[model samples]
Target: MSVDAKARYAQSHEYARLEGDLVIVGISDHAQDELGDIVFIELKEVGKKLERGQVFGTIESVKAASDLYMPLSGSIEAVNDDLQADPALVNREPYGNGWLIKVKPNNAKDMEALLEAKAYASMVGEE
Candidate 1:
């Protein structure tokens, strides 16, 4: 269960990392691990607006399928097209090449409401 020190986490297991004006979003490493080998992902179109905690997408693994939630209110800027070709990237590098979406946040301060790496680790019992 690896946690990215620079990222904030939602209780549902999505992670958000601010980069310039965009926030990168993805499932936590623990989430990918628990889901086993990922086979598919369905994400919303770029430019769609979503509120925090709203379902933005879905990920399907050999073990099960799960909804992907928005960690902050934002408009989708980009979707990782690589995942469609190799969904296993999520299991290999959840915080890097496995990232799901890039969002232009409506309020950057919304990130402060999310759990830090340490808190998230503790919440998931990785601490």
Candidate 2:
């Protein structure tokens, strides 16, 4: 979970990138790497509201199926439907094409509590 100051992360390993009122959501690179080959992706529908830390979707990998947590509260504005056919985008570009959803933050103030990149590195250290 190599978080940058520009990004915020959850204990469950989901990440948030705040932009204006929108926050991009994705799983960390470490989580995807650990999951190995992803086989399927189920994403939250657009317009759906989610609270921070809520289970929003599921990622299925050769290793196992795991829940995806919302890193911040907001309404889902978009989902990367491309992932349904190509889940490896997560492995290929965890921070870019791999992003799972885009949301509008309901409480920007809470965003400050997420882990900084250095802290996240330390949190998932030496693995």
Report each candidate's C-alpha RMSD, comma-separated, in the order given: 0.5, 1.7
Ten-residue segment with the worst summed lDDT in candidate 1?
A: 118-127
Q: lDDT of each prediction vs. the true structure? A: 0.97, 0.85
TM-score of each: 0.98, 0.93
CA shift of 53, model 1, Å: 0.9
In model 1, pairs of residues that clash are none
The sequence of per-residue lDDT tens digits that candidate 1 reaches over residues 11-79 is 999999999999999999999999999999999999999999999999999988899999999999999
lDDT of 1 at 66: 95
lDDT of prediction 2: 0.85
